[model samples]
Target: MTASSIEIRRLTAADAAVYRDIRLEALRLSPEAFGSAFETESVQPVGWFAQRLDGGAAILGAFRGGELVGIVGLMVADGPKRQHKGTLVGMYVRQAARRVGAGRRLVDAALDLAAQSVELVQLIVVDGNDPALRLYQSAGFVEYGLERHALKIDGRYYDDILMAKDLVGRA
Candidate 1:
């Protein structure tokens, strides 16, 4: 599929069912990539997922031929001292959707939304995910630090790479 065929937009509460499905898929398929586990989220009610979209966080989804194929979220910090910052989280593209520009579109849409309210956007990617590393880097995110053993799943330790992008001058 071409990049032009993918449509990116903010998710709403009504889209919760598909969001929950894809979210569980992401957590299940790449457990080490996220801090949340499939076992924990799989049991949550659909209302919980709907609240996630209705909450302050801005979650964007990529639709290919009207099917939700990818998602990314931008959460602006609410604290007094950190309101100028936002976090890019829950980024995932389905196996069938990878390499077709869904990932990049999701990131771009999230960053665009973030740039509106925050000067900086940060994210943590599990180390060794080269495609993710490249995607974030291509979007101007720079690595600031490494969190060793950031995720310990199934007795296996996985490091995380912390990245951030400054949105000082972007339009």
Candidate 2:
């Protein structure tokens, strides 16, 4: 499906079930791309995911024909010194929905939400994910650092590339 047929919107507590399904799918399909483990999140209560949409973080989803097909999250800092920053997280587009602009729309939606209260938005992409790397670059995120052994999955280590985007003009 193409992007034009999908609607981008912020998720709510009512969407917890669908969100949980997609999130777990992402962690299971791409273990190296996220910090959260499917083993841990999959067992969490549905209310846990609902609370995530209630206030703690802003999660955006891409819907096609009323079905949630993609998602991305933005968490704003709460500390005194870090309140002006936000972290981009949990980005995933189902295999069937990829390459039709769902990923880009999700990132753009996250950035749009972050721009409301943050000066900068940051994210960590697992090294060697060229498609994700290119998507971030196209959305104006620039790599700032690299962390070796950022994640260890199945006894294998993977690096992470830290990236950030200044929201000067967008804000």
Candidate 3:
């Protein structure tokens, strides 16, 4: 399918099944890109995924022809001190959907939601992931730091590039 044919929308509890499928696929295909392990999430019940939909987070999915093909998650911080902060996570686009603008649409949706309430949106991308870094950069996210050993999988460590974008202004 073409990029413009894909539709992006917020996910609800009813979407647990499809969400789980794409999520597991992401974790399996790119283990270094996320903090969650496929082995841990692969066994979770659909109810567990459903429950996640009710939190202080927004999960956006890209669908083409009614089939979910991509997803990105945004989480707003709780507590008075952290209320203006939001975090981006779980960004993934299916191999077939790459270079089709699904990732950009997903990020734009997340940013739109975040702009309503948060002052800043932050995300961690694995080092050397040029495509994702480029996406975030094009979306106005600037790298502010890097965390060494941000994730350890199968006895190997992967560093994470910390990037953030100010919603009120591009600072």
The TM-score of candidate 1 is: 0.98
- Give one digit per residue, the lDDT tens place, for model 2 in 29-148: 999999999999999998999998897888999999999999988999999999999999999999999899999989988888888899999999999999999999999999999999
lDDT per model vs. reference: 0.95, 0.93, 0.93
TM-score of each: 0.98, 0.96, 0.96
- CA lDDT of 119 in candidate 2? 95
Q: Which ranking of candidates, highest TM-score first?
A: 1, 2, 3
RMSD of 3: 1.5
**Count of backbone collisions within predicted model 3:** 0
* Best-fitting candidate, scored by lDDT: 1
Q: Residue 91 of candidate 1: its Cα lDDT?
A: 96
Error of 1 at 11 (Å): 0.6
Candidate 2 residue spans exceeding 4 A from truth: none
Report the lDDT tens digits of candidate 1 across residue range 127-163. Answer: 9999999999999999999999999998999999999
Weakest 10 consecutive residues of candidate 2 by summed lDDT: 108-117
Candidate 3 collision pairs: none
> Best by TM-score, which number?
1
